[model samples]
Target: MQTRTHFTTRLAALVVAVAASALGCSAQADQTTDKIKSALVSRLGIDAGDIKGITKTPMAGLYEVNIGTQLLYSDANGDYVFNGDLIDAKNHRNLTQARMDELNKVDFASLPLANAVKVVKGNGSRKMVVFSDPNCPYCHQLESTLKSIDNVTVYTFLYPVLSPDSTAKAKQIWCSTDRAKAWESWMLDRKAPTAAGTCDTAAIDSNLALGQKMNVNGTPTVILADGTRLPGAVSGDRLEKALSSAH
Candidate 1:
């Protein structure tokens, strides 16, 4: 009986090996991906270009669809779609949100830093980018939080999307000879920016265009060193923790 069991196990292993050899793993995966892509375009009526790629998720039968920066999941057959977070049952972690963050990460060095008002504190070893509106109350709140943070460099891009008043205020701050000081003075002290000189305010315009291109729709959008887009006015401690973790 023992010998028969051993022979059966070896036979099963041999059969699996033969099957794997007949159809390579890479080729099998590619075939599945192609089928999903075809289903996305034909059955789902999603544009072929919009369907970036279909990849298997940690859950065996589920697959992730990369649609630009957003992530959506579908069944193995690509019939049903899931639009919510994929949670790990055992670990109690939001795996979908984590994957989305990874996919949506931007390149920190790719930003046009020259157009932004640079403020350095302490050793300035940590770096962060912020899209802020001068007239935004939340931006003012974020500014207050940023003031408490030490050993960091903040690149403030004047993103005036709130109102027309925001644009005027942004222009004034950007046109100032001492932009960094002017920005802090207004945000921290309630001191309005002085009248702008005839100096070229092209940088402000460039910043506006750049902000639009980056799809920054709101003020106080903070980007940490790891290219994580943290929207809204977060507390100083949270911001500091993120900076530390990235480092």
Candidate 2:
């Protein structure tokens, strides 16, 4: 299953909701949004044949509108426009969550796995990837949890963003005797690796740049085999559960 996630919108849903009552009684939210769509077509002088689905959202003044593959919002009365988050102040709910949930999935999978060192357990029957920082407390917690799982292949990218010291520690791990064993040992036993003979190891810098490009701001961002990204530390049992249903 795709994980549900929400984006922070720029406007308040309360404003959209407040504008809903100002709409004509003959106009439903969808119809009102259509009117906005029709107006835009007339103004743009397009054929207006590409319009597909229109729906009313919980947003106060704006309508959550979809046209073919494009997504936008229009005022309840077809007066204004919107292109960002729709926040609900009363319930503290995000109206745009469902839309953004499927947005970043593809780019998540396109990440280069070769930059990450692989760690296999048991028969390697399953696969998951983790972005971790050597010195992050949460990453340590995730490392402990991944220990219990079996028959799984793990690709770990050392994110190393805690501080300057963490970068040094990560460089040592990347240049250690055994990339896999050294990582597991360092993470599980707090056994810091010895000084790397060469200080010019590229793995640390590579992972840092990769993390930045992938929007991995913190450690322990676990991406399942199916390309769905889950951000946070998860338990062993929970990890197993996720694997069971993941592709």
Compare the candidates by TM-score and give the number of the best one: 1
For model 1, residues 1-247, the per-residue Cα lDDT tens digits are 5698899999999999989887897787888888777887798787888776789999988889887646888876778887888999899999988887776577998998998999999999999999999989999999999878999999998888778878888888888878899999999998999956346778878888987666676888888888998889998888989999876
lDDT of 2 by residue, 1-247 (tens): 3333322232456567667766654366446756877876776453466555556676556566554344667766556666677777898877676554454343545767777879998999888888888888888898888878888889888787888887877788777767888888888998887857366567667878877655676678888877666778987888898887785
Runs of candidate 2 exceeding 4 Å displacement: 1-97, 106-109, 197-200
Q: Check candidate 2 and list the clashing pairs.
A: 9-85, 10-85, 16-60, 16-61, 17-60, 17-61
User: How high is each candidate's TM-score?
Assistant: 0.77, 0.62
Error of 2 at 180 (Å): 0.9
Clashes of each: 0, 6
**Global local distance difference test of model 2:** 0.73
Show model 1 residue runs off by greater than 4 Å: 1-52, 197-199, 212-217
